[model samples]
Target: MDTQQDWDIYDVTIVGGGPAGMYAAFYSGMRAMRTKIIEAKRELGGFMRTYPEKIVWDVGGVGPVRCERLIEILEKQARTFDPAIVFGQAVAGMNRREDGVFELTSTTGERHYTRTVILCAGRGMTQVQKLDIHGANRYELANLHYTITDLSRFAGKRVLISGGGDSAVDWANELEKLAKEVIVVHRRSEFTAHERPVAQMRTFAKVLTPYRISGLYGSADRIARVALTHTETGEPEEVEADEVIVSHGYDRDFGNLVNWGLEREDYGVSVDAKMRTNLPGIFGAGDFITYGSKVRLIAGAFNDAVLAVNSAKMFLEPSATDMAGVSSHNERFFEKNKAVIEEEKQRQQN
Candidate 1:
């Protein structure tokens, strides 16, 4: 870990590397503030990274964008200002300094200081729920996948999806088109996902309800089959599978934020319309923020990020504009990005 004294305090420190945090980093650069983004994961994009193949349609202007593609675009946009980014570091605690700067310590023992902080740490650290059956861990990397980073891995394979949630049903529907066979096993008859996709999945994929995964079996290196037991009758059944997708859902926690002394609800941190939390110089946004009429959508999170960044700017410099003008007409932006813009235009012209 680098010594804290060796580093310069940033004008803004954005937590979490999801879309909201990434956008905040970009806007902070537009505001000409020195910024840094800290993400716990090895990569950016937050939960979207787990669903790389899923298509995102709600974000305006970008129609039907693949999850991986959107994340790449957002990462590029965030890097426009070249903010310092640290990955695989989870913030463990924070403190306010006498000079009004914030000091953050990570679980890795590294420290960072900043003028202000944005808690875009969406749902904090999240881990996918895994199968409890014996020998499950042995096949985790071989054949059992909690998330789909590459959809082609299941191509022409027999896939078994264990869960009744939206992700499970969605993956089943998606894999049905590529996989040789797709089966969905759930512990309950009723699914927890939206009805439309579930109904669509029934049309193609085999649905086995009121059943729980009992065992996993195969060679020492790979999983070839899974045993399922009926939830009501205790009857057992076996299915041959080339891959297993466990989408039971994620176990999420706010990590150190729970002890940060902020006012929070059962869902997430509470904030005002300005995205200001109860603490001064600290704000919250993304799925981890809660406010009246707040919608849990990527679009909503983007709006939240903008509001939080603008408020943070004002908090840093009272005379600064509350809102930035349109990027298209901003001469300073064009000047800063003149070469890149010109190159893009040249490419289009060709």
Candidate 2:
């Protein structure tokens, strides 16, 4: 006789653990729904993990805070409902039952049961673009870095950064005072980063526009010099550096979710005003979905999450409210609110 727990069927399963997915999990719990989150990566934050040090001031009511700190806060909020979180599973297969339940299979063969699916897998399974030069991988363990894990690591050391996007410029600016020298190499003279940041980076870093890294020169395992060639004239130049950073970009792989017959455009999946995909019980938020008036920002992703979660709730119960009640008056927060009040009172008394 086998004594085993029955398969758990969630009211909604969110794909991806980024801001949108995290917020959806919280909102769904507020609506009294059983929820789960399946994340491809071992951790959360999604694309934001790439720039953990960047200051994020755009989030409403959030004074300029580091992105990594915001991620920690968001993760805590997502776990408020104690939803099951599955990590390091890339969703590859989706099977729907006649009774309307969905069985999602990961590439590793794990299965999850859910009544509704919300794809917040922004830049699903992103692969960082590395330096394409031959033998570049040799220095990766030494002085070559694809992403900035610690800005202080380059303190007092010369740093060479390649790319023209916001991340590249941001890195250059951040390392300006920390590093002995900051060099920015880009294939195009016109930077794609925001105008102000680009201008700010130009004031300090050694800007090599319309040029690209051609080769890396070093001994043993660490890169000591970088060969750069002009994009138009092919003029070559070499610069000595103790560290090399590549911020080219990332390649996105949505796995097999794109094959589920969801209407999609070149940018992302198509969704209605209520964040509902054409398929019933399926929704999208964050960078995974596109509509006529999509706002590509963190705050925008939060708005999408609310709409998507509410849509899923209404799908499960047709008579449900279009949105959750304000948190200030929400009964679910009554105890939590009291706890906070008590803590504050104790602090004041002390």
Per-candidate TM equals 0.94, 0.93
Q: Local distance difference test, per candidate?
A: 0.89, 0.91
- State the local distance difference test value for candidate 1: 0.89
How would you encode candidate 2's per-residue C-alpha lDDT over 29-144 as one tens digit per residue? 89989999999999988888988878899999889998999999999999988899999998889888887888899999988888999999887899999888888998989899
The number of the candidate with the highest lDDT is 2
Off by over 4 Å in 2: 1-7, 346-350
Predicted structure 2, TM vs. truth:
0.93
For every candidate in turn, the CA RMSD to the true structure comes to 2.2, 2.5
Q: Show the lowest summed lDDT stretch of 10 residues, model 1.
A: 1-10
Which pairs clash inside model 2? none
List the pairs of residues colliding in candidate 1.
none
